[model samples]
Target: FSLYRSYFGKTSLEYHLQTLENNLTNLVKRNSELENQMAKLIQICQQVEVNTAMHEAKLVEECDELVEIIRQRKQVIAVKIKESKVMKLRKLAQQIANCRQCLERSSALITQAEQSLKENDHARFLQTARNVAERVAMATASSQVLIPDVNLNEAFDNFALDFSREKKILEGLDYLTAPNPPSIREELCTASHDTITVHWTSEDEFSVTSYELQYTIYTGQTNFISLYNSADSWMIVPNIKQNHYTVHGLQSGTRYIFFVKAINQAGSRNSEPARLKTNSQPFKLDPKTAHKKLRLSNDCLTMEKDESSLKKSHTPERFSGTGSYGAAGNVFIDSGCHYWEVLLGASTWYAIGVAYKSAPKNEWSGKNSSSWVFSRCNNNFMVRHDGKEMLVEASLQLRRLGVLLDYDNNSLSFYDAMSSQHIHTFEISFLLPVVPTFMIWNKSVMILSGLPVPDFVEGTSLDHQEQQQQQMGLCRQESPYLTGMKNCH
Candidate 1:
């Protein structure tokens, strides 16, 4: 029994030892698998690190390339800026050269003009001398031909007196019966496609019984329709009423020529013709004169009733004289001495003369002869003259004349009227004062004080000697210089 028990115990011990061995082997295999898996993870981590390093290096290289590209672009922009600056400098230099050339040409023209004037003066002097010699020779011949018994001195005196009387009569006849019409005074008026206003005055002494207004319309074709002959078209305005007349109900975009004739018991004196361009829109007056009544006619002769209602409402702005403390009182006191004159001419007309009082406090003390003329006012431009009060043809009263810078190129010229010499040219850059009240008059010389003259004439004059020297230098560089004298021996 003892031997069998011991053998069973030994078998059980052997079985337990085998079970422990098997469990150890399984634990070892599991540990080996875990070690392999850790090794694989480590390898993957190393590969990832290598890849990250490569990517970082590549990114750095690309960043360096981008920086270089940016630097190159900046340099290119800088170069373009410099090139643009150089181009502008070149253009400025060209402009300077052109101005210099123009100045030289003008100088040459002035020289030529001066020479021509000198020649004309010399010719006139020679003609005067010849006429004086002829008169002396004729007088001497008449004395020599006289006989003793004929009372030669008396006869000669009588003949001379008769000749003088005949000459005076001929001159008078020429003055009275001149074929040419008197100068017409033109006033600009607002005229549109639908309506027009005509204003005129006559300087002649003839009694005007009626005024005949004539107009011609162009139909855009070869034929022009004359309104003068048409009975319905003629307007026989009595001279007892106002001088101004308005014509309305005309086609748009049409050009019309207008004229006036004064008819009386003796005869009819025809006035010079003027032109007006019509617009489709209604006529409008300048805001300054909007309150003034403007005439309108439904037919050329028949007046319209509702013309005043169509005008836009406007209030006159109060005139504020220069801020001088006593200016307002001075203007009022000198108002009587100031006189306004309107000149009408073909193609342009304006109010010209403003004579002021000499004394500020005296009723008629200040007398300053300052002229304020405007060719354009409101929308109306001076087209032609009829008599007095310029004939204006426009859509509205331009009132441009009252504007500071409203200067007519021809009207503002500073010329010696008696000598017909050009003294200066002025570009109007300031508003013109109203006639009569605005001028600071000096009666002694009949000139206005502080009136703006031409810019070139103000202050110091151009130093022609220095300018010529500078011009010579520039001309030599820019253009071929020619010697003034020829060297032919």
Candidate 2:
């Protein structure tokens, strides 16, 4: 009995010690994890603090400038008031001198009337009295009221041929001398690669007769070719009466800066030049799901419409009938975000978007819920989904366009590639990966963009890699990530 009790007690003691050791190991692991998380939280809080400081500084600067402008304007108004008061006082002193002469003239007329009465000539006496009254009338020179011989007809001589008493024509024509330039209100590139639209606010501050648009494309070297033939060097779009202008004939995938000048009677005013970059993207057409009338190039990156005959693509996934000229893109996405541009070369009608694998063929690309598209029917623009249509106004010359897809957020958007105008966006509940889609109408050609997409992910895009290489110094002896690992060890 004594041997058994000793054995049981020793066994129980060993088990308790082993359990305590295991508990200690778990607690250490948990502590390490908590420390790492705390460090990450501290870093995030520091970043937020820095960002807040930057924004606060910017707001403070703008507020100070606004307050200074108010102060200057107030000073100017006070100076003008002082000058006006001096002028009024001088005029009042001159009027007092005139009033003395009027009193002397009145006394002379009254004395003449009394002399005529003494001579017994009543008619002469009455005439002298009438003269005295006329001298004292409100119409006398010493009276407060002063009138200028200004004619309404004369004022409206060049403004209008016919003038009436009730209807006074203002100075209709703007002054020939150039006025200040119109300030830019908004500007953007269009769907067409070579076109850009600019809008400026009409300068109510200055009378603007017209405007001229000047633009320059960045041509690598210092040499630049003007759009218009002008020796002065700047190409000009003259006599733009409206506040908005759409500039045509620009190169695709190029950078351009536009300048607008408002002209009036005195001089011309120029706005601060605006700079923009055209959209760029590279994509290929998938021939496996291409429709009959759509012919894919050997490179499979471009598609053209051929109504003469059908190409022999036997894929069951292909479009048919109403959608007999559709092609899917080689790239498909299920996660992350991407942007791509397409050049629609003189195409009358076309559609661009992303479509699910099981999208219906009987309906147009945008008419099905599985597909979301920005489509053009002749000159009209429409965003269609699930047979519903939302019409939007875009120029008839839309050529280059862009698509932005966010798979994780389930959002798709389209824009004019040249001007960067937001055309449309669709919220999607993606059940499957969606492929880029192209639709052709009549005899249109869809040119896939050759520019690379903006790389947002770590390894998905070339631009992202280049950015990483620049930031991380890929050739450095010790990378920041490596140094971090070493520190952790």
Judged by lDDT, which candidate is best? 2
Alpha-carbon deviation at 141 in model 1, angstroms: 57
Model 2 agreement with the true structure over 1-489: per-residue lDDT tens digits: 889999999999999999999999999999999999999999999999997798678667866886797589779977876786676666665656666655566566667656656865678768866766665464456334333232233322243323353234223422244565567754333424446677777555446777888877633333323333334545679998888788776554355666787876556767766655444324578787778877778888677888765657566777675544788887666654556777888887787888888887645786667888888777667666664555665767677787776565566766676765556556667999888888877565555453433332212333333442442233223333223321110
> What lDDT does the true structure give each of the candidates?
0.39, 0.64
In the order shown, the candidates' Cα RMSDs to the true structure are: 49.2, 23.0
Candidate 2 yields a Cα-based lDDT of 0.64
lDDT of 1 at 434: 26
For model 2, how many clashes? 15
Candidate 2 structure, TM-score to reference: 0.36
